[model samples]
Target: MAWNLDSQRPIYAQIIERVQYDIVSGHYNPGDKLPSVRELACEASVNPNTMQKALSELEQSGLVYSQRTTGRFITKDTSCIRKIREELAKQQVLEMIRRMKQLGFTKEETLTLMDKIYEEATYEHTIGV
Candidate 1:
């Protein structure tokens, strides 16, 4: 998948978010080995140094850990993964609500629209649309 990075935010920060999403979404399973920093940099079209910085930050957060000679691996702690997943979801929801409010949507109206859109999306998925 493309990293789809933008200039609006720091590249390393974007990389962190991408990696976190991959972990939480099961693109990388618990205890799964991650690609090398060079490999990840190539994949994200970023500099190795930038990828290193991002991965280092992830390590600090206990999301990924390095094993001396081996490369980095995703944390095997399911609870930690769940916490990160929930944090990510909350951030997304908060952003969505902020945007909706800016567009003049009341909280209730936004909820209603969200429900409608979700139903439509679920139906589309069910029908293989």
Candidate 2:
């Protein structure tokens, strides 16, 4: 439940991103009830209204839903979750490629670096790095 906020962007936006990341990272599984606004606010050290605003936005985006007498829950739509995951992955890859190019690597060289990095990462993962 780490909350990282900075002065550049609004806190609520950061909350939304963090929550979305949690869902995609399996920290909050599909159909899981989110922590209450007060709880989340406390965890994130922000005003309850800010957390509420963030959660409301998430619901509007169809990544979360609310039920009467219950609470907000992660969307059970696996396809939507998969799509979000894909979008996030694409963002990461593009950012990495941009950085690589800035470091003077050509597209093919950048891709080859990606393969090397991926192999090392996979090996580390397999050995519980």
Candidate 3:
């Protein structure tokens, strides 16, 4: 995994987001083992403590669980994965809406754009594009 350290967000927060994205994207599937904090920190060139904190936050969020000696693994619950996906989708939509508002888009225009997006996404899914 590559770290974009120059991003506006804090490194730890970006690390958490990257891990979450990996989970959601199936790069780290349910019940799959995750790299140790030290390993991940080395890979990302981040502090071990920061990586640990991010993993701890994931544990707190129920996206991952720790087992004695075996280390941490992704959650096996499908509902938990679905919940994470829903929450991420809601966050992305809220951010997009906020940006639109800042750009002076009217509510009706935002809704129309969202409808168009939905149609495009549906078409993409239908055509496997």
In candidate 3, which residue ranges exceed 4 Å CA deviation?
A: 117-129
lDDT for 43 (candidate 2): 89
Best by TM-score: 1
lDDT of 1 by residue, 1-129 (tens): 457999788999999998999999999999999999999999888889999999999999999999998999999999999999999999999999999999999999999998898889888896444
Task: Write one digit per residue (lDDT tens) for candidate 3, span 1-129.
Answer: 467675576788888888888899899999999999999999999999989999999999999999999999999997999898888899998998899999999999999987898789888886444
- In model 2, the clashing pairs are none
The lDDT of each candidate is 0.93, 0.89, 0.90
Candidate 1 deviant stretches above 4 angstroms: 126-129
Candidates 2 and 3 compared by TM-score, better number: 2
Question: Of the candidates numbered 1 and 3, which has the greater TM-score value?
Answer: 1
Q: Quote the positional error of residue 55 for candidate 2 in Å.
A: 0.6
Summarize candidate 2's per-residue lDDT along 1-129 as a digit string, tens digits.
Answer: 457788598999988888889999999999999889999999888999999999999999899999978999999999988888898899898998888889999988887887898789888895444
- The weakest ten consecutive residues by lDDT in model 2 span 120-129
lDDT of 2 at 7: 58
TM-score of each model, paired residue for residue: 0.89, 0.88, 0.84
Question: Would you list the rank order by lDDT, best first?
Answer: 1, 3, 2
